[model samples]
Target chain A: MPYTAEISRTNPGCFIFLVDQSASMSDPIGSGEMVQQRAQVVSDAINRLLTELSVKCAKEEGVRDYFHVAVIGYGHTQVGSAFTGGLAGRDLVPLSEIANNPARLESRTKKVPDGAGGLVETTVQFPVWMDPVTNGGTPMTRALGYADSLVARWVDEHPGGFPPIVLNLTDGESTDGDPTSAAIGLASHATADGAVLLFNLHVSGASGTPVTFPDGEGDLPDTYSRLLFHMSSVLPSHMRSYAASQGHRVSDATRGFVYNADITSIIEFLDIGTRATELR
Target chain B: MGAHSTHLDVQWFLVPKTGSSSEECEDAIDVLLSPETSSLFAAVSDGASESLLAGAWARQLVHGAVALMSAADEESVVGQDGLSRFVVEDLLARTVDQWDGYLAKYEAERIARGRPITWYEQPGLDKGAFATLMAVHMREAPADPENPKAVRRWIWRAFALGDSCLFHLRDGRLLTSFPITDGHGFGITPQLLGSRNRNASLIADRVSTATGELRTEDELLLATDALAAWLLSHPEVDSGGAGRQLGRLADLDQELFAEWVQNERDKSRMRNDDVALVRMRVKTEG
Candidate 1:
């Protein structure tokens, strides 16, 4: 089985990463000054997913030949740059060049643990695609609608095969509109062999309890989380291997959401998700 | 002639990625010809390009069909209407039933491994592997001296699931031909001859158009897609003449014909498929 069911290294599916750039995510997590900032952690995690996906493309034939991928970041009620293209608010660009292009360094910093029991701050340039932007309210509902169009077109072309996966990393409710219907529609579009999988990475509040939605409660105003979770693709085996290598163990049963302030869970999730999609 | 006498010549053309392997080709051809009373039967099955293991499927059909029919002890038919028609139908049914079982076991194995089943999601038909089949049975003619040129009669009943060809040539002219089943272009291309939803029975019924007498000085040539294209392009060369050439093949260098085919003939006109040719000379009139 592939990593993200639909997105492969070859004709890798399009992944629209809807990051929560609403000023709140910048806060430190759990009163731990020692831990890296949440924004930095999220960016690091996205970078890790991109690296894992790129490596998979080089090693796996099916992933290299069949999978085509694109990453779109939605934040502050508007679309941001694609992970590979760096274009501001462009439509999804299929990932043909990203896998073949030479690796270049993008400026990003993270705290590395000093081997001698203490934590030493280290700044390293990483391969970056989309920079985090914080501007307005979370338009998660609108993002889901946009995802529906993108995914639906892909499914129309590959109806008898696995539908592409859409993984959304968000921490709050949508301010634009109800995203439940769009998410539901996305989940229903699958191939004859397998269906589309949508998963959400919920980064909880820093100081307070994390806000989670779609907890089987009809009272929730939006079903954004519910639909995203439902549309998440199956976690492939090799991705689990990558996650295990990254010191995060995940099983096949693990769905889209892995919530915590550490943001490491999101990194692991994307790593696994990207790797699974690369499988033949 | 004794009923036990076998007369048909079978050549299995492994079309690049299609058809049975050389090792299994004999066994598969034997299976399609298992009727003891009428020992002569020839078949050429072209593997589906879309399938991952099209060659294996073709081999399985031939071997399984012959074994099943032989065990059943089906009555032997007479003439073109009898032999070709009956054998094609019988082989098709037997092959299909066995194929269903094969698929069932395959699915079971997938379930055991806890892997998502995608065995049937072969690449698109245009780019994928698939097979076509053509089988023929010949009977000995009666011993009659009235007509010196009296030739044996042949029942050339054929079934085509894919693009392979079954040709009958008499006096250097085309006697009759079977239609190739052109399937839906995209998605799962329809199985023209082999088992995949549409089996030999349905395809034989749909594609079979010619059924009649085959006279001596006549030749029946059955081929896979590539060789069929090659044979069709070279209209000037008589296969009957080629059949005669086989007798003198050992005296000449083996490279001569291949060199002629590649260097002398128009390169694009040749079929890239594995070629299987069967030629029988009629000795008596039926």
Candidate 2:
């Protein structure tokens, strides 16, 4: 019931994305045709997630501000808003503003089923809000702390609403220090609905079968993933149900953690909050 | 011998679900009165809120259903053994075909206007427009020459593909409720009619049908899921009290109905959703 709170424009939920922009993120992940810089992959995931959220809440009038969002980038001994263009340096912006003020829209070609067995290539408008940035060391602890402050304030302000969700996208390396305590502290903040949800997307170069929404850390490839898993909030029952519905092997104990795979699926785990009570 | 006949009193109301403005109401209802045949047809469709252009799809479906019923031949109208599987299936398949054409035109228009479909909208569109459909038809049986002064009887048939319900009341008591009977029956995933589903047999397999008799003063209520669910949840419905409440609304205008729905939603007695209802009463001449 915690995650079941109605998410309306009047009682919006919050999203805090912590993106690791450290130098090591510049390294290529996954060899061969799938190879891409860790930073690029994370940036694409963030952008796609934002687009998905915007589209989910979109109506004829435009996107509803059912959520407020923040994108924080940490690297080179600095942590700040990664939003570019018109929204540069802004934090916790309403979803309507985010939808209307995309840095730019890119026309991307996609192949879709043509209803006659084959695929048809078509152009689609894709909006971008942030670009890949790689700098110095991975100060992940500070990044979690930054999200912590935001979560603390958001819960205080929206005490009766669904708790904020913090998604940390990072490579396994942490140059600053272990982020366990910081992650725990970040997840400890609460609203009347529930405690903050700290989910992790480990964008690693290490090659292993990608594990997503695992209940235990036994299958994790490295200690870094295990640490992040330990710091993650268990998937609320509703999120677990959604993950199961999406064909992911989920259990009651499954945490909101995705390792070495596309984290775009995480967007589906968040309840759009408000039920369709009115249909206009 | 004096002639006896029955006429229909029809009224309909629609309100968008809570949290949505009135302009966003996606549920659609349509009634087709055929004075020449002394028959009345009504339909309601609830568009899946998750799908793109759902409101347009729902509106098209209900209109298509009514049109199909209006044009049915004698055999199709009476149906095979009281259930018109073929007619129902053909209606659904044709609606899907019509939706295909609509989607193409919609896409072309968007492209022509320099606002092509966004990546976000494409996936939902490909899944096709989703909606639940229910339709009812009522026709007066020919009067018997021997008993010309007897009360006229009307034959009524209902077809349902999802959670939408049709409730029949006689003498102010609940007579029958079709498709869904309890509030627990409503789920997040109701059976939906997909715009791209071309298999008539598949559509026919999911369709449910019921037939009954309506005499003078009998009332029939057709409702989309939200209002139907609320009606089913009340214990009074079994005792006919709920039917009386619905029958009383036959003369109320849309604004009053909207207020009643809002009040129910405020009390948390009904789920906030686009609410639709069509009330039909059988009238008799003394």
Per-model clash counts, in order, read 42, 14
For every candidate structure, what is the RMSD over all alpha carbons to the true structure, in angstroms?
17.6, 4.0
Model 1 regions lying over 4 Å from their true place: A1-12, A30-33, A59-66, A80-90, A99-104, A107-125, A207-254, A277-280, B1-286
Best by TM-score: 2
In terms of docking quality, how is candidate 1 classified?
Answer: incorrect
State the displacement of the C-alpha of residue B274, model 1, in Å, after optimal TM-score superposition: 20
Candidate 2 yields a Cα-based lDDT of 0.80
lDDT of candidate 2 at residue B50, scale 0 to 100:
74
Interface RMSD of each: 12.4, 3.4
Model 2 misses residue A244 by how many Å?
2.2
Q: Which residue runs of candidate 2 sit more than 4 Å off their true CA positions?
A: A105-126, A173-178, A209-211, A217-226, A259-280, B1-5, B73-78, B81-127, B171-173, B249-251, B284-286
In candidate 1, how many Å is residue A221 off? 16
Question: What digit string (tens of lDDT, one per residue) describes model 1 on residues A10-53?
Answer: 23455556566766666665455546556656766776665555
